[model samples]
Structures are given as C-alpha cells and as structure tokens.
Target: MVATVDVRHETLRRLKSGTGKLATAALRELDADYRWFGELPAQERSWVGTVAQAGITSFVSWYANPTGTYRGALEIFAAAPPELTRSVSLQHTLSIVRTVVKVVEDNADELAAVGGEAHLREAILRYSREVAFSAAEVYARAAETRGAWDARLEALVIDALVRGEVDDDLPSRAAALGWKPGPTLVVVGRTHGPLGETQSAELRRSMRRAATGAMVGIHGEDLIVIARSDQDLRELASSIMESFGPGPVVIGPPAVTLLEVARSARAAFAGVVAAPAWSLSPRPVLADDLLPERVLVGDTGARDRLISIAYDPIVRAGGSLQETVATFLDCGRSLELSARTMFVHANTVRYRLKKVSELTGWDVLSTRDAHVLETAFALGRLRDAGRASL
Candidate 1:
C-alpha cells in the first residue's frame, strides 16, 4: 500500500498545479482524490460542504490542515466568503476569521484605559460569544491589564487630594473635587434653548477659567460655585451671564464659614423665591447685603413695644422704613448727609423726617426724640431680619 505521507504529498502537488478558482480547484482536486476529503473531521467536512453551497471559493481550503505548510498558498488564492465578504478573504477564510477573533481578544488595553477591572469583565461577556476560538483567553488578558490601569488612576486622584495639590483657596479647591462644605453659593439656571452635553461641559469649564479661585459644582441641573473672595464671585457671575446670555443668576451670599453656608443659601434662595418675576430675565441677585432692607423690614417685630410703637405703620407701607432710620442715625441727624444717602433733595428728606416725628409725636429736632428714634430703628431692623426667616 502507498504510504499516507506520499499520498498527502501527491495531493498537495495536484492542488498547486490546478489553477482554477480556490473552491473549484479544491473540488476538482478532491474529486480526483476523494480519500483526502474522507479523512477530514466531521466539522471540517460540514464546513466545506456549506462553503460550496454558498458559492464561496475561499472557504473550501479552510477544511485543510490549518497550520500546514500549504496554508499560505491556499490563503493567497482565497476569494471572499459568504457572510464574511465584508470581513475577510474567501481563499484563506479561516485565517481571516482567526484575525477578527484576535482583535476583540486584544482590546483589554483600550478598555482598561477608559475604566478597569469592572470594564474588563464586562467587555469579555460583551464580545466573547461573537468571536472565534480562544477569544475568551484574549479578553481575559485585556481585562486584567485594564483593571490595573484603572486602579492606578483612582490612586492618583486620591493622592492629589491628600497631597494638597489643589489651589490655595480652600472652598474653591474643595468644590472642584466634589466636596460639600458650609458657605456655598447655589446658582440655578435653565437654558433658554437646547444645548449639547459637550457645550454644557465647555461652558462650565469657561466659567471656572474666568473665576480662577472659585469652586464650582453641579447639582441636578444647576451650577453651584463657592468663591473665596468678592472679586472671584463677581467674575464668576459675569462669566456665566456672558456664556449663557443675559439671564439672571440667583446667588446666596458668602456664609461666614462652611457651616454657615446653609443659612446663607436659604437667605439667597428666599430672595429669589420672593421675586418670581425676575426668573425669566436672568439677572444676578446677591443674597447677603443686597436685600438688607427687606430682611431688616421683616425683622421689625423683634423690637420691644417702645420701638414697634414708633415705626410699625411706616414699615407696613412697603417703603423701606428701616433704611430711613439707619440713614438718620448714620448722618448724626444732619439733614445734608441723610438727604444724599436717601438720594432725595434736602427738602424731601426733611418731609420724611417731619412725617416720622408726626407718627410718634416726637419732635424731629429734640435731643431726646433723636435718641428714641435711633433705638427704635435698630430694634425694628432686627425684628425684620427675624421675621424674614419665618
């Protein structure tokens, strides 16, 4: 009997000589020597039959020994396979399939750069079943590498925080790192038109750049920033307006410390809440000193009966009754400074003073009455501040 090796060598020589298309040559060679096809494994035989039926010439040679010396020659003549026409050549269809499987297997580094171990496992499950032999092994290696990279990145972030590598202003630096503290300024806004996520992120970055020493955070749909100085606060406000267009930003005043931010935030929130009309206009409203008159007006009830008796009616009238008293006291009862502060002609200032005297039956020019009015005014403001809280 002829040796199997001699039979294999003769078959290979015949295949090389037959220059018809890969599938056609394969079939012709197999027909001349049917024993070779008979010797193939069941799966290989089935694959060859499927390739013939699909009119794919490249896949015919895949049933041959995958790592044989003739493998390169078979691949060179391969045509596009059926479903894999977009992916690889038909003559060397098995090699093409193997390459695709390898890519998904090797993607561990890419995935790890974006995330880490968590993502590595996810990627394996995502692409494994879709790829060819040994794909699971490839993905496993990738996941391990990716997980390691992610851990490194997280360590870096924590190290930066512990090392105090952030900026000098405590509040601003903390805000950037998503820390919560007292004395934060909450800024709430809704865009007038649609914006992409990229645009929103860029806008936030621009605001931070402009503010320099401000800490900015995102709460739901709003931007909250904490500034260490009035200058940073002002710049942040201005930059936001410029970027978003002229709309109002309601800012709570700086809390005395981190612990006081909540109270300051409440006051600022209340100021905006009271003025719903300005919500559509997009102006910046400062919570601390801007609404002092209103806060003082509301606090008038805190005064003892003597002070209330002097200023209750004037306060109820909607004008700033507390401010008039403060101005009077600040001017040392001088009508000139009082007039300038009240932004009125001296005569108009005199008229209001006259009215105050009449309300309490206290003479405006009396030394005793001046002292009484001063005390009453201070008490009324304190009362208003207290009432505003309610």
Candidate 2:
C-alpha cells in the first residue's frame, strides 16, 4: 500500500505539467474525426472543451488520491457554465470523455515511466467505468423525473374527461401520452392491491401485446380502464376481474370518440357504485344491463336510458306490443293469463311477445328481461306525467 501511494504521488506530479497539452490533444482528435461534435453550437462546443480539460486534470488527481477524487472529480464538469448536460446527451459526453481517456492511454507507457510502481493504465480503466456509471445515473434520474410528471398529466386527463370538462389543451395533453383518439369503452372496478413487481410488469406487457391503446388509473378505490372500442370489454374485465378486491367489474357503453366518452365513464362509475344491489350480476357486468340497480341508486341517466330503450320502442310499436308485455309480466310471465287478459289466443300473445323481442330486444319470456321492462314501464310513466305537468 505504501509503495502504491508513493508511485501514485510520483506519477501524479509528473503528469501535472502536461494537463494543458492533454486537453488540446483530446480536442484536436475530436475535431479531426467526430463530425457530430463539430456541428454543435459554439457555446456547447466550449462547454465540451471545458469538460475535456476537467477530465484530464481530474485523472491526474484521481491517480494519486483515488478515494477522495472519485466522487467530487466529476463536479468540475457538473458545475460547468450553461451545464454540459443541457444540449449534449450523456452518450455524446461519454464519447468526448472517451477521447480524452484514449489520448492518455495511447501515451500510457510514457506516463508510467514517471514511476515504476504506478499502474497508470489500470487506474484509467477503472475511472473510465465509474465515469460511465455516473453518466448513466444522471440520465436515469432524468427519466424518473419525467415519468413522475407524465403520471400526473395522465391523472389530470382522466379527471377532466370523466367530469365532462373540455378545454383547448386537453387534446394536446392526450397527444403527449400517445393516446390515440378513437371510440372507447370505460371499465370500473377495484384494483388488486399493490401488485407484485413481476405481475405489474406483465399486466402492462400483456396490454401492449393486445395492440389496444389503454389508459389505466385509480380513483380512490376504483380502478378505471379506458380501452379502444374494438377491444372486448367483457374479455378485458374478465381477465382482470380477479384483480378487483370486490364487487362487479362494470363496463360502460362504447362512446364514438374519446372526447365523447364522458357518458361512458360516468355510467361505468355509477354502475360499479350500484353493482352490489344485484347479487347475481355477471362477473364482467354491463352498465346498460344494470339499469334497475342504477335507478335504485338514483342514477337519473339510467332511468332515462330505460325509458328510451325499453319503454319507448314498445309504445312506438302501437300499443299491442306494450300491452302484451305488461300483461305477461303481471301474470308472472304466464302465456295463458296474458291471453285471457287480452281475450286472445295464447298464440296471439306469443306472436306479440316475439314482435316485442324484435322491437326491443327484450323477450317477455326471460324473467330478467321482463323485470327490466317492468322498471322501464314505471320510469316511463313518470316521464310522461312529468312532461304532461310541464
């Protein structure tokens, strides 16, 4: 150890006088060969030149005081005016540093002749690796900072879109996140708590492979996913349904475009809130299919939907289809009782029911479908009475 120190000190003093020459040689080599560096603005080029000079002087100090200089040696470059890191990428900076290191390395034998015991070439190699790692650290920190800002931007977009707020800047922010504006469906559920690192990575990887643009965020306990319209909501919900802590995975109706998806996002959120009312709801439940529960939870939009989709269609078919459904439901879905009420053959009731299904897509024969129609009738009656009052 003592001999190594002695050699380091001796070599350090001998190389001290040539630090100016070393920087000039490095710059001459860079200017002669590296076309990229030559094209940089004059100010940035001056910064790079300062770093080159610092690199040579730091090397001489580091050769002698290995422990002390390793950490602080890079500060000279770090504290340079205008900051060398601003315009010059770490990659380009490393190239400049490499040229300086190479200049010294090419003169390694001559530099070593100053002291027999000093391993000048070995010291340079070790310092070169540390410099590379330090360069990488700066870029890594920048990436992490950018990532945090992006996450905030994404959350802001979700809040605005979900709340139906629109402004001139919304589209630009979406573009920043690489969101492709298209028809979309919003899904709401609870996210499985704090996924393992591997599981979290795989979830993103799987989503990318699916070739569907998606934005995922957590609003309190609800996990929301906005996926492309062509992506099957049921499949997406089912695949990650288990990840939800509890309750149904509710999918909203498809919106024609992302800017128009507030309705879907709102419906998805409302359906998930109301999902507990229906114990038998499908694992991946549809918001449109949850009209009864949504109404029970005071979702006026769901009430409006049922009135429009279920009641209006039947009523528009000119009363026959409407009467058949009302009779069938009142009779507990009994064809005979419905026929008796209408004073017609059961086949006539059946034919009307078929027509009802063709018109409204809800079969009087389906108990669930019938129940939905019942809710629609009650809401539709109230709607007509309110309009009459107005």
Candidate 3:
C-alpha cells in the first residue's frame, strides 16, 4: 500500500507539471492526507470513504472542472467501489493521475477561455519543441536506412542481369539503371520530404507495383527509372501517375542497344523542358523516331520555318504544297508517279508544282530541294513528338 501511494503521488506530480491549472486545482482539493473513513454514519461514511480511498474523487473533480473555474465539485459518493486485483491494484491509483492528465488535454481550449493564456502558451511551446526534435530524429534514421537500401537494390539489379536471371533483352536491363541506350522511359515523382533513407524503400514498393522490372535510381532530387520493354514502360508510367499525382512523364523511342538509354533519357528530359506551360493529366507522352528529329529542330530552328511553309494560308489555298512535295519524294523523283499519286490530272499536278516552286523559290522538281524538305519534315515531327511527351 505504501509503495502504491508513492507511485501514485509521483505520477500525479508528473501529470500536474505536464498540464494546466484545472488538474492542479483538482489535486489540491482532494486533501488526500485526511482520513475520514471512521468518522461518519455507517451508510454515509461507507460511500464517502470508498470514493476517497479509491482516488475517484480527484478524477471526477479534474474531469468536471477542466478549466479550474467550475463552482460545484463532482459528487461520486453513491458510485460503487471499482473492481480491484493484485495486477491492476496499482492502476487504480494511477487512474486518478490519468484522469487529471486527460482533463487538461481535452480542456485546453477551456483553459484558454478562462484566461490561462500564459500557461497555455508555455505548454504549447514546450510541446512544439518536443515534436520538432522528434521529427529530426526520425528523418535522420530514414536517411541512414535509405543509403543501405540503395546499395542493396543496385547490387541486386547488377547481379540479376549478370546471372542471366533476366530475359535476353539486355537493352532493357541497361535502361533500368539509367544507362543511355535502347528504347527507354524516364519517370519523375515528388517525395514527401527531402530525399532520405526511406525513399528507396518507398521507391522499391512503387516499382514493384508498376511491375516494370527496371533498375531504379535516385539522382539528386529526381527519381530516374529505366525499362526496355515498351509495354512495361507504359504500365510503369501509368502506375506512377496513379500512385503519385501527375507531373511529367516521357518515353523515348526504341533504340538498337543499351548504349542508347542515355540518349533516350536526354530526349525525355528535353521533352520535359519544352512544355513547361502544359500540365499532365495522368498521361505519359511517347516519342519514337521523333526524338532525334526534335533534337535537330530545337538545335537548328529550320524545322519551324518548314512548318510555317507547309501550313501557311497562302500555300494551302493554292493547293497542298507539302502534300505535293511528299508525293514527289515518295515517287523517287519520278514525275509521272508523283502526278498519279497526287490524284490530279498530270497537268494540274504540274501547275501546282510550278506554284510551289514560285512560292518557296526552290524547284520542288530539283533533287536538292526534295532532300532539304524531307529532312526538315523529319526534324519537325521529332520535335513535336518530344514536346508531346513532356
């Protein structure tokens, strides 16, 4: 009993220190040192002693007067004795302390309402500081875990490839590791906080869910995922959009080998740059043979000029100048087939051909002009594809 009393007193002290005025006032009013069990009539004293001895009176007071301003105290005289046993006997004493603590927590607003501003502010500042310290500790632990997981994941990927555990599409294997070669897709996702240790675990889970069978790596602030199978690439990308909110996703056209993944990644990166104004709606953009073309167009600006020429109102009103050029090129420079493919009387094709020559100041009939236009068209298509991906 003495041990239980000491523990109860200590616990109440902690609760009082942790809380505000209501809990402290309730504890003071309990007058725990007084023993009135033997003084009153048998029935009345029986109820009063039970409440006082059980520590229930203090609990009731704390719970009822949470802000320490209630005019009436709680009356638990008629309540029956709480069940007690050897194991939980100490708990009965602690229950009073817990009750006080709970009242303080639940009535923080009430305390503030009752003009406990200084006390409330001090409590809030202390709680905030504790939470901040705990969060920093958690972040540090996560960072350490992430570093170990990264190394393990990298080794796992390299070992799987070397042991022939993966299928013979070596390019796909290379692409997953951010290597530059083969058909590839690059996906970027935002994390909850600055990159730390748990990110690798979260990433691995995401990759497994995407089922891309690709090697995933983190480069600075970006998540770089590579995969060889176009189907897997598409599925992985779709899953990422669903799991994380849409941002930017880019898929590069199939390359011949793993050495081309870097080129594909660069193309995808460029795509992300082109459409800064456009937002993704959970969709991924695909660029096939257009990647190289886009690079050329972006580097040289000639592709834009070609588009202006092809779609210009003056060119279209006269006749489709670009279509005529396409037919001419497809016919291997054979004027007869070019005229037939145009679906116009050879005389009409000839006249439109004349008009194209006059407007562009280049003879569509010339091999040099044909070559230049074809190259420009290819470049324009690639650039367009890349932009779509971004």
Model 1 Cα lDDT, one tens digit per residue, 176-222: 44445433344544443555656655665675676543444343344
Task: Kindly indicate the candidate among 1 and 2 with the higher TM-score.
Answer: 2
lDDT of 3 by residue, 120-188 (tens): 444434433433344344345444665565466665554443233554555443444444444455554
Which candidate has the highest TM-score of all?
A: 2
Q: Estimate TM-scores for all models.
A: 0.32, 0.71, 0.33
User: Among all windows of ten consecutive residues in candidate 1, which has the lowest summed lDDT?
Assistant: 55-64
lDDT of 3 at 230: 48
Q: What is the C-alpha RMSD of each candidate to the true structure, in Å?
A: 20.9, 5.9, 19.9
**Which segments of model 2 are wrong by more than 4 Å?**
1-124, 183-185, 192-213, 228-233
Candidate 2 structure quality by residue, lDDT tens digits, 16-53: 97788888999999998789889988988888888888
Tally clashes: model 1: 23
